[model samples]
Target: MRKALPVLLLSTALLAGCAVGPDYRAPALDLPEQWPEHVLLSAEARADWQQWWRQFEDPHLDALVARAVDDNLELRLQLARIQEARARLGLARAEQLPSVSAQAEAARERTPGAASPLGQSSTDNLFSLAGVLDYELDLWGRLAREREASEALLEQSLFAHDAVRLNVIADVVATYFDLRSAQRQLRITEATAASREETFRLEQLRFDVGESDELALRQAQSELESTLAQLPSQRERVRVLEGALGLLVGMTPAELMAELDYGDTDLEAIALPDGVPAVLPSELLARRPDIRSAEAGLIAANAGIGVAEASRLPRFNLGGLLGSAAGDAGDLFTSAAGTWGLSATVMGPLFDFGRSASRIETAEALAEQAEVQYRATVAQAFNEVRNALVTYEASGERVEAIRRQVTAFERTLELAEVRYREGFVGFIELLDAQRALLAAELALSEAMRDRLTATATLFKALGGGWQVEG
Candidate 1:
């Protein structure tokens, strides 16, 4: 029996090296070699892309992004999930090793006088100390497959955390840009309101002195009131944007209620990035965390098929016990009181109405779902990059066009004012010129905001400067 046990163990060890089911291979994808011809790209170093928000050259924005990375609730939740996956991986690894336990016992019993050969009852004590060992032999590599799946899940968790982190950073930057835009709009409205009020006062004085008619005076007052009416809505927009920015920067409810004080930063002053990185479409698969996370999930599902397949085969377990037994506790360790045991167990599904086969089918179906999801994630990533590139380029062009429009309106307003004062044009013409200039200036402000926000979106779509480590 002893010789046969060693031979069986050696044979099982050899079989353990051969696993059941399919191995994992990365899915192949056909990707473009270059971006569309209309998309602008730059062959620039990506070192600065890691903290892409710093390109705006605003210290306050840099600080806010840093705070969001450290304190965002969503990021904290992902970190906790990572820890849980790590623990599960540890448990899976432990299953591949042996388990040991120690036990000690003491017992005393008295036999009835009638049951004993001697006519008197006697008390006896039994003392024992034992150590037991149990190990599952991976004859079909089931434990190894389980460990592989657990490792992939851990990778999935890590990449998922990175995905959330990328999103949080992007949101903070985009919200900051929006807040600045709203502030700029509010300032434009306020300045226009003040100018109109001055114009109204001058018209009132001219009407009283008979230089301007009541019609001109009433028109000036109406324009002034119209500008005044926009003040409240613009101010409210600024407040709402401020609240959004505060939340993105991870401010508590109390802190937001107290009003976040982002220093006076002008929207126009924010520098536009010169160009975006020129990376091939295939390279995007490596840079994006969401794509990597999806692939990890697929790999895990692939490994699960092996686990299910191995479950239909036999499982071999080896167990052993070494101990000492004696009538007295002091004599438990003596040579005459030694005890030992060895056992081998084989368990497999004999007949359960195809239960094992059903499990294998379920695993296969889940694997197919994961593969489809992976492909969808990759497709979505490419679509976003394409749209962001187009939007960013178009926004820049729009800003330039609006700037030229503002310049032309400013000149027209100046000419109208001069002609009206010289009695060559009516006050109605001057009013139209003033209204056009104000509208153009407001549009220019909004266009500038959109350009900056578009740049941020492009950066996010390109995976925000994250790279896979070697």
Candidate 2:
């Protein structure tokens, strides 16, 4: 019976391949076919959204994005998480295989002849060596289900890491634009301040010559000081935004400043795409990383249900030991000195009232939660895309309107300056015109920034940068 046990266990292992509990299937979603009608891109152009930043046609932006990809701390952290998940997957896979160990022992002992029933004293030495094997037969496929769940978790980690990469790219791009916008605004304020100082000097000279009154001179001086005060704040904003961009790219403030070449930085020179491509709402399920991560979680949870169900059934463990034992070392391995044994262990929950039932219930509940979360993620993804589309469209219109307004303000300032020089209008009219022009210029810069940021947001919503395989 002992000799035949190994063969019987092997045959049982071959027959016990079925896993208990439910198999995994993706939950159904009532997805939309198309996005909001106002969005501009044709379905055929969706592929072009990949590498959307390249459309900006700026070398400096390209360099910054590459640096962020290589060194951003958040991205590195996600990569480490991928490694952790991969190690866990390896551990789960190892459980499916047999475990083997080498065991050895040696001893010397003396026995009284009376104790040995020999009526004489005797001494003996014993030595033994054996190789032992232990392996769970996986009768209900518990180990297989565990391995399946682990693989799903690994996939989830990978998708999450990709999501982080996409976010990092978007953050770096948006922050770089913010830095440029601040620099542009600062320059406009500085130019306005210098122009106001010149006006104040001319007003002071005219008042001293009795051509202008104290009231007019003081108004000019007030406008000049107000414009000067704005300079310090604008400069400060530029500095702070630069620091923000530096952190996004994992660089220190000093390093960012040195690399920025602030003197040559030209915010107005960077151009944006005229139109962004649109994608079908249904396609978003495969495109968005967060959605994919959620789905992976669901798969793992579904596998967990099988694992829990399998745990309630009986487990079969097969083991064997082979060795030789004799009074002399030379006699070990001889036919008469050989020894071997095999074992089979069958364990089942005989009296656990509700523990297995509770575990199965818990697994089912978690699986349901994963399904609901997946649906919510998809819904939220669509909402963000819709909002981005609307904002992008409105931002473009605002930029165009501000440009026209700036043009009119420029002409008004020119005419007001002429009228003031001819003494046909008071200095108050000139100051008002100058103030309007400065405000319009600043508004135009802000509008442009918004338009660019809206475009990036739309790209992010559409999951522009990464591809998940079907």
Top-lDDT structure, candidate number: 1
TM-score for each prediction? 0.95, 0.92
Candidate 2: where are CA atoms >4 Å away?
Answer: 2-11, 38-49, 109-123, 252-263, 334-336, 466-470
Tell me how far the alpha carbon of residue 465 in candidate 2 is from the true structure, in angstroms, after superposition.
Answer: 2.2
lDDT of 1 by residue, 1-470 (tens): 98999999999889889899799988888888888875444554555667778888988888888999999999999999999999999999999999999989899999889989988888999999999999999888789999999999999999999899989988888888888888888888889889989999999999999999999999999999999999898888888888887887778989989966888888878888887767778888888889999999999999999999999998899999999999998888899999999999999889979899999999999999999999999999999999998899899899999999999999999999999999999999999999998888888888888888888888888888743233
Q: Which stretches of candidate 1 lie above 4 Å from their native place?
A: 38-44, 109-123, 466-470
Model 1, TM vs. native: 0.95
Cα-based lDDT for every prediction = 0.89, 0.85
Cand. 1 Cα-lDDT: 0.89
